[model samples]
Target: HSLHCQHPNTNFCILTRPNTHTHTHSMVDCHILLYIFPGQGAINPALQFAKHLIRMGVKVTIVTTVFAHRRITAPIPEVLTIVAFSDGYDEGFKLGDHDAQHFASELRSHGSRAIAELITASINEEGQGHPITHLVYTMGQTWAAEVARGLHIPSTPLWIQPATVFHIYYYYFNGYGDMIRKHTTTDPSCPIEIPGLPLLLTSRDLPSLLVPSNSNSYSFALPAFKEQLEYLLDTETNPPKVLVNTFDAIEPVALRAIEKFNLIPIGPLVPPPSLDRKDYAEWLNSKPESSVVYVSFGSFVVLSKQQMEEIARGLLESRLPFMWVIRETEEIGDKLEELEQGGIVVPWCSQVDVLSHPSLGCFVSHCGWNSSLESLVSGVPMVGFPQFTDQTTNAKLIEDVWKTGVRVTPNEEGIVNGDEIKRCIEMVMGGEEFTRNAKKWKALASKAVKEGGSLDMNLKAFVDEL
Candidate 1:
């Protein structure tokens, strides 16, 4: 089916296929339909693959929540098609406060029906008339896999985080769940061993989903994560194929850790620049090459007033020109006037564009996988101040395993103070070792995404198999 872009940002894209009399069994899978389900984070990597699939002459469609669709900061590609659906929370899912179980349940119910309708609508002669051949589901949208199973469609789960995190989740659900809970309950920072992983992970290094119930409270995401992993390990008849957003050279051990599944690495799925060439052109031009600090905590993750103050002070204390993306909700108080002395504080900006800018010297990040990979590919050193979820684990790898950055340690009050933030920023910006390591990874990442590279081959293999 060919897509007709009738209007800009419209939820439905008009698709053209053959007439009713011309439709037949041969038309079922001839269209090479690829339906993608994407969860929220920085930007949807699904869109990156959508462009690739479009170039490959595949019919691609993105089925995501209306909220996510609205939140997209850049212009949608004209070649690719997007279809938005209801997920009960059209206003957007509140991460820290929303009921995880209820969110999962609602997402499963609304999203499953929406997907079914979307697939059916495209296949029918009276509708789009293109039969879906394969479905690709991204992280946190495990219910997408379940829906595909019920429909007897071939589906692949895209692991957005590092392959090591996937290995950890598999172990958690398989047999180590109880032990991990027990150990972490006693000491949130106690070290433990997981099969296949070489490093000793303390609770501070584990994904926040694995943290047990206590004064820190319980995690609502565990159930959904468990279901996702169980579906991968148990429900599939043959070995399930998993697509990871990582390069084989970077995570060879973690990628090979699971023997039961085919984990394909086909990323740094970072998209090309979509912003106006002159949007931040002037700001970047004003700064010296490799002299500005770029700070962002991704889409979610709201810091407290105290934390915000500390970060603001830290940026000021460093006496470095910086660009910090602080969500509008947090008021900076009197520091707003002072912040103008050293930097700019906007609600958001084109992160990729900022990272790619010649002026970007260091990144003060929350270590979300997308941001981490962006920094790595852009050769920007980091000062990691992880908040929750897989961020802590990513920070651990950044500071310890990969040695691309320094992780900030909070004080006894569990707040990373301004002084500590300043110290980490200075260390990352001043040290040559971290900068050198970052540039090396950047080259390797660039190589992996090039023609016939490891990630390139992996992506081709996955697409060809379909």
Candidate 2:
């Protein structure tokens, strides 16, 4: 006799008939294959999203580069399976903070063909069983769309950055190259009005590549970015839907601007479970509420030796109890040595757990999308010291639009001094006006992510459409 049983959550397990068994109804279901970008700060949110979907009784599989899986130490939530493809990139070659970007570029060049082959191989492995029902990909790995097309499945693009960044690129693709170039170069002080966007943003808020000057770092990165943007715009096959990792409460204006382009906002998608560290939790819980400051610069940006020294001095000068996640590139000079006597400097930490801790009063950050969302959801205000790329834009949103943070001015060499750092930190940590504004944003952020909230409903609608 054969036995067929279904779990409370609708997960099925089948047992074959012992002998002379009668025919029974077949039991199989659709699966979701997530193709992820290998960028720093990309995997954590993607993993969280996958976990939530799996809990809803959907099967989920993540496909990514080998290097990314190894480098990012955030423990993968249970119930999610990860499939990694080899890019022939060696992890032994220590490039410090350049690892994520290097792996992404190499994956684009060599991993695309491998990813295509892997998808076909995975499908064949499942033969006559559960076929893939949906293909979700990150913007970094645009090549996944090709594989999704070959499989004839619906593909969706997930943007880990802000919606404004995508809109800026879309504008660049629609024959505004000369205007964008002119505005970027001739007028750093001038505010460039985006055609489809509701809010007017200054040139300083746009990605460095959109600016016209050849002297900035974006000048070199622009060529590759332009090629990627062009690939996303060309609609030769199945045009995938776009999704951003932001809530409407934070950027309702930007959200409205991208509505005509068919973008979906389903975010503050941070993991619900705590990071797997009991000792750390105990340590954090020992402190009082709003007593500690959390510091981290999202993976890629590195500060010069002088800049690092100045920041270290400032932290010590402020005399606040802080936890700083120093990237491998942040070398300790004399100033850091002095501060280490008073504070903690870890190479990496359980970010979500750290932010959610009652001890965490404020965040000093580079304003990366993932970090910003985490801080907002955790009710921590910010002291923005943006280094590059969309970080500048994110800083503007925090300090200007949201009124929850203060921006520090960098010196001629683009290094923020000790006094500026101290001043910003004090303002974010204890200043009455800044604290009140931070609480207001915190309440709005909480409302946006709760049950029946905008992001929750939008996510449900997005899944239904699929």
- lDDT per model, in order? 0.76, 0.69
Q: Which ten contiguous residues of candidate 2 have the minimum total lDDT?
A: 7-16
Q: Which candidate has the highest lDDT of all? A: 1
- Predicted candidate 1 versus true structure: per-residue lDDT over 218-280, tens digit per residue: 365666667777777777777788888888767889999888888888888887655577555
Off by over 4 Å in 1: 1-39, 96-98, 126-128, 213-218
- Candidates' RMSD to native: 4.6, 7.0
Residue 144, model 1: lDDT of: 74
RMSD of 2: 7.0
- lDDT computed for candidate 2: 0.69
The lDDT of model 1 is: 0.76
Structure candidate 2, residue pairs in collision: 184-212, 185-212
